[model samples]
Target: MSKRRLMNTAVATAALAFLGACTSMAPKYERPAAPVAAAFPDAAASGVPSAPATDIDWQAYFADARLKQLIDIALKNNRDLRVAVLNIEAARATYQIRRADLFPTVNVGMNLQRQNYDVKELYTVGASVSGYELDLWGRVRSLSDVALANYLGTEEARKSVQMSLISQVAQLYYTMLGDEAALKVTRETLTTREDSFKLTKLKFDNGAASELDFRQSESLLENARASHALQTRLRAQDENALALLLGQGVPSDLPGGLELTGQGLVAELPAGVPSEVLARRPDVRQAEQQLIAANANIGAARAAFFPRITLTANGGTASTELSGLFKSGTGVWSFTPSITLPIFDAGRNQANLDVAKVNREIAVAQYEKAIQTAFREVADALAGRANLDEQARATAAATASEEARFKLADLRYRNGASSYLDVLDAQRSLYTAQLALVQVQTAQVQNRVALYKALGGGWTEPKAQ
Candidate 1:
């Protein structure tokens, strides 16, 4: 064959080979079975609710306007969330690089040479494709697939981070409200105790009451004062924690928040079947993406054992003088095709394949573990939902009983029908009951937040109006 005809045939052959090398050697991927129960253990037996938790936008889920504002701020400025977003960007860039490798990189070049002091300038100008791999066994494609999966995984990870941030902000905001409520109770108790202490002291001085009664009343007053101080400190700490979650200092102009008892979170969120709900979780999706990447790695490792073909080609004109570089008769072209078959590399290719298989196995295990972990979290949150509301109700009832007992005890003591110790005991009991009620209420609200998060709520934002 003539030189020109031979070059054209070779180029055509390479093009056909490139078009035919699309087979992947990776094992067929099937998602591992979820190693958990079919349904959450604490899910109600009646039926699924009208709406799944995932469908409820966080804006509508949290009734408090202040909480919605805080979540918005956290999504925008939280450092951890910011890092997650940046990671997605990095992963996308890396994927772009890998994808670029699937195509030849063409470049234009010019060279001039002078040998042995004979200033014969060989001027040349050409477009060249250097060492471009013909993906005969899908190695480059497999790597590109891996990068794409990883990029998708990072996007899911960002969603997971945002969900957690929303949950944290809501829980902490409820805690701060509970702390404020407890502080109010403590201050009220302190005031009542101070008045009681003054009355007892006057009676003791007038010989109508013993010094023991006066001392007992004074102890109650001091205990109330201590509780007030402790609650004050706790409320401040809660606010600081909330500020951190908000990614900025708590603003003074925040809209008024609902009382802890009034936080109208969706009370009866549906815990759908585990297979359905867990699949929607961003963490679980992220894990599956990672597993896909690992699977693609196996294809690349298998490809390593096959022959690799690379092509380097240049076509243009060359002349001894710069002005003749592009002349018709000065044309020159070269095509150098190289092939590398793995003869023996001390079992390195086999070892790499082994590593890839093991890594894929590890990914499978992790993916299942992610599903199991999600199952447990949702189960635990559902359990809390089933019990905390009743607990709060019982605690509130006990607090009311304690309040009435304190009133009766004080009345009896004033009528000279009972010892002052009875009144003191009743005061202590009422104060303890009040604090317990606040704690229970706080837990109840936080439990709802946890359930919402476990059900994969809060990752989605409301559409812009």
Candidate 2:
């Protein structure tokens, strides 16, 4: 046979061999069973209205205009979220690189050769494919699968970061409102006590009130002043925290937040079935993708037991004279195929396969743990939802009653019908009750924000502009 005919037959045989190598050694994939309760305990009994949390857009879920504005700014600017998105972009590029390995790479080259023995010069020009691996054992395909899984996992991670940033912005905004309310209360209390102190001092000077009464009045006035100063510091700190989340200094013209009691967040967030809801959570999805990646690694490790085949080929024209390189009868071609089979490696292939399996097992545990953690967060948020509203309501009623008692006690002491100690105790009780009510109201609002995040409410696929 001529050299050309012989080369054609060899190429055909290699093609046929590659066509026969279709089966993968990778084990079939099956998702592990969920490791938690079927439904959120008391999710329905918590009186939350029944609607898919995911279906509610963030703008509607947090109805305050200022809050919506803050969330918009955060999604656009938060540094952590920006990094998460960039990571997805990087993973996608890596996956593209790995996928290209399934096909042969082509190159064009020119070369000149001289041999001393023959005293001849050869010129050649050709397109070449060098050392392209044939996926005879599915090693390349498995690696591609691993890369794809990682890319998908990174996308899910970006969503997780977005959800956290939205909730953080809302929570910090509510805290600022709560502090503002407390400051208002302290200022009013200070004004009232200051007037009372003046009256007590005047009465003491007139010999109608004892020095003890004057001293008690002075103490209450100072206490309110101190509380006002502390609340001033706290509110400023809350603003600074918000600025960090916004990824810039707080805007001088930023709109004020709704009162803590008036924040219009949805009172009830439906958790649905734990298994179903957990499936939608980005963190849980990310963990499962990681598990899939580990499983794909096992296929690559198992492929090591089989032969690795590589093919190299070049075709062009060669002639002693450069001008004659492309002339008839000057054409040259070469095809080389190589195979590598492991004979002995101190059991390295087996050890690698074992490591892959162990990693798969570890991934399984992490997947389940992700589900468990999501379930716990949702349950905790639901418990807060069920109880905090009632707590705030009861605390508000107590505060009102204490305010009335203080008025009565002051009147009685001014009439000389009661000791000044009763008035002092009444003032302290009213002040404590008012602060407690404000704190409970803050908790109720903040819990709504928590439930929104725990249920994976804030993020959606950004629309193409």
Candidate 3:
């Protein structure tokens, strides 16, 4: 058989041996414990009954067209996502490097040496060929398996990055929408106060209202106008932030303004039991893969304790006369098989083994930590979702009540049934309520995004492009 065929057969045999050993020693992976409420019993006691988390597709979940567009733009343009793609490619190259360890390394070299000698002496010229070192103890095979796991881990990590990026984009979009809604309320408040001021002034001129009424109306109008200006500024800032997320200039114009009036409800979130749940979290899975790689390294390190066998072979021709160099009579070949045993290396192999085991232990702890953290995050996000959903509803009701109170107060003041102080109080309360509603709405959307991320949403690779 050819040397290449022999090498392949040897590698196969070694791999089978290693795999058999690995199967016997490898521990079954289990996720560490985390504190999550088994039942969110009070969740429905406060707000509109929320369904249990659902594993809905992101495309269908974020119903707003503009928001979806922004998310898509961010997925394409986010610098972080781009960096993650590069990391995946780097991991792929690293995997290739490790996979190559099991195979023989072959190289071609040429030598040209010329030396002058005494007249009675003759110069000797020689040339030959060399093959490669063969892996006989499965060291390279184990290392290659470790690298493959790490590579797969990196790919999953990239997907996790993508998911997070989408969730952030969605949240920012919702924030902009909420800002625009607030801006609208501010402008409307300003217009309403201005009209009320004009009516108060007319009443004062007709000798029916006092100068105090006109002054109070004027003050309310000024405050509302100031609020409008501040809301406009805030809206501009929010737009600038969204533009940056889209990888555009901060001053880039947004085609669609925030439109929250008809914003649809979020879909349910996904819920998974603890069994192999770490597989869903990219970071946790990455940690586990590192642990696996570290485990494999132990095998590689153990193999270092055994003897290494290397075989070298060369075939060529050498002759004093250049014409005879290619003749059969000048043919030459050498085959060398050598063994290297750790007789006295001052404990280098032992130190390496210790280091590998230590690293493996560290990886194991990290993998467990990652899994615990992921579980905590998912549970916290769900609780936030439940709380924020209730808060939004309460704020909405308060806003409606405050709006009615303001209207009634204005009517009573115009009809001389109450002092202008009541109108001022009503107007202030209405503004506060509206602002609070806006905040809670924003929170609800953002928390939804967070929950989606906890459930591993948003980072799916695009198809066809």
Q: Which stretches of candidate 3 lie over 4 Å from their true place?
A: 1-57, 108-137, 199-219, 250-258, 276-278, 317-330, 344-348, 462-465
**Runs in model 1 with CA error above 4 Å?**
1-17, 45-48, 112-119
Output the number of the lDDT-best candidate. Answer: 1
Better of 1 and 3 by TM-score: 1
Q: Which scores higher on TM-score, 1 or 2?
A: 1
Candidate 2 — which pairs collide?
none
Which of candidates 1 and 2 reaches a greater lDDT? 1
How does each model score on lDDT? 0.88, 0.86, 0.69
Candidate 2, residue 259: how far the Cα is off, in Å: 2.4
Candidate 2 lDDT by residue in tens digits, 164-264: 89988988888888888889889888988888898889999999889988988998899899999999999999989999999988777767656677877
Candidate closest to the true structure, highest TM-score: 1
Q: What RMSD, rounded to one decimal, does every model reach? A: 2.4, 2.8, 5.1
Can you give the lDDT of residue 126 in candidate 1?
Answer: 74
Please give, for residues 1-465, the per-residue lDDT of candidate 1 as tens digits.
Answer: 235754685577567446735777878889888899987997983444657878878897989988888888888889999999999999999999998888778799999887676666788887778888888788988999999999999999999999999999988888888889999999999999998998899899999999889988888898888889999999999988888887899888888778888887778888888998999999999999999999999999999999998888777788889988766688887889899999999999999999999999999999999999999999999888888878888998999999999999999998999999999999999999998999999999999889888989889878577
Model 3 has a clash total of 5
Angstrom error of the Cα, residue 440, model 1: value is 1.5
